[model samples]
Target: MRKTVSLFAMLTALLVLLAACGGNQTGGSAGSSGAAGGGEKKTIKFGATAGPYSDMVTKAIKPLLEKKGYKVELVEFNDYVQPNKALANGSIDANLFQHILYLKQFATDNKLDIQEVISVPTAPMGLYSNKFKTLDSIENGSLLTIANDPSNLARSLLMLQSMGLITVKKDVNAATLSEKDIVDNPKSLQFKPVEAASLPRTLDSTALAVVPGNFALAAGMDLTKALKLEEMAENYRNVIAIKTADKDSQFAKDLKEAVQSDEFEKTIDEQFKGFSKPQWMTGK
Candidate 1:
């Protein structure tokens, strides 16, 4: 009888130990899920292209979020597509890089359920030349390097047209405009379409290079050195993007409020000198 009682007690203790371990495992799972859900999360990861945008998040947005009792982390991407991919896969909570138009198109193409949180100050595309001091010095038949992607290429052409170097055919959609849209090339400037990232390198050999702002900044070219910067359209400004489902989440609200904060504008003015502020910022 005594041996049976002792054996029973040992079994009961073993059962209790297993039950406690199971309870702890369940609690851990709940805590992880809670962190991923709406208002409970204390950490946020932001993805950005490695340049001005990433720097903006680090110097400006991160500190604001930190003060609000959140741990902020930034992941820098070298290419455009991966940032959105990372956001969609939950590798990041938000991203700051592409403009609204690009965001919409990319989402459509990839079927991502991400949406913009708020627009931010964006660097504008500019024409740079190591061979010529000014647009006037550009000779007829000079080779010009431009971004091959349709969106950037269109902007490059538009900038050239604005400067009276070329005239695009009327009624052409600015978003889809191409070399074929050019009706007149007064300078007879030959365009070599290359990757946007490669445009900065072309300055060594090409007479002129039209570089998008991010790549230019990444390449360490001075924005002030550009012959001219494009007049940024509102839709062309970069934005903070998050999962569509997170639109009403506490984290999303905090991210939007952070951008709208006066501290953010002050940081932009001090650190991001040449970037064009979004309309909402300027309207304030």
Candidate 2:
């Protein structure tokens, strides 16, 4: 009888131990699955040029991302080169200051595998001058400054072409435009290629300067007073970029969603005050 009782007790304890082990195994499997399902990454670092891009992220995108349980860190850069470098080196998870053309050119030139996640508002380039109020007011042989980087230099040249100040070859692609591409210069406008960030500061010295929209805004130039404004196009619209490998990751998707949300649209409208127009909101 005692042997029978001992046997029964051993069987119950064994069953309990087996159940406990099974529970542990199930819990472990669930944890693994949860991670695979993209359990929240605690923080994401976003890089941007110091100005409107950084401002928008802090005032609008940051709060929205925080609501999704992500701690968003906004890293501000002063130049065009550093933001992409930071992104490439993983110092930042993503960047939001460049357009498709510039990003493509930068990636190709540097051999970096970067990709755009979403299109943001555009700060259309503007021709600003301290010496002249209108294009007609400028004289022949006047000095003009433009961005030196290939992408923006091309864009600036195209803007000059559009203003009837110069003309490029009909078959020439705007992205590949250069000073040599200027087949006609009616104004005899001498060109000086300067760093994009310095164009605003050059206004005090140069006869005229073609300032990027963000830099113009930073320097408090009146856009309405610009001699000419570059027409906004899809390629010119600024975008959010990430590593090509992370383009489809959950974090990238979340960022896309956040920027495309109605709340973000309203925030941009209120804060940017038409300094930039959201391409997505306008159905562009």
Highest TM-score scorer:
1
Question: What is candidate 1's lDDT per residue for 165-189, written digit by digit as tens?
Answer: 9999998998789999999998899
Question: What TM-score would every model get versus the actual structure?
Answer: 0.83, 0.77
Question: Model 1 Cα displacement at 220 (Å)?
Answer: 0.5
Model 1 TM-score, 2 decimals: 0.83
Question: Cα lDDT for residue 46, model 2?
Answer: 86
Model 2 over residues 1-284: C-alpha lDDT tens digits? 99999999999999999999976543222112111234434577889888888998898888988787677788999878988888888788889898888899899999998999988876789888889988899988999999998878988888888888999888887667899888899889999998887899998888989988987888887776888788777888889998887776777878888988889988877777645565567873
Task: Name the lDDT value of residue 241 in candidate 1.
Answer: 96
Q: Among these predicted structures, which one has the highest lDDT? A: 1
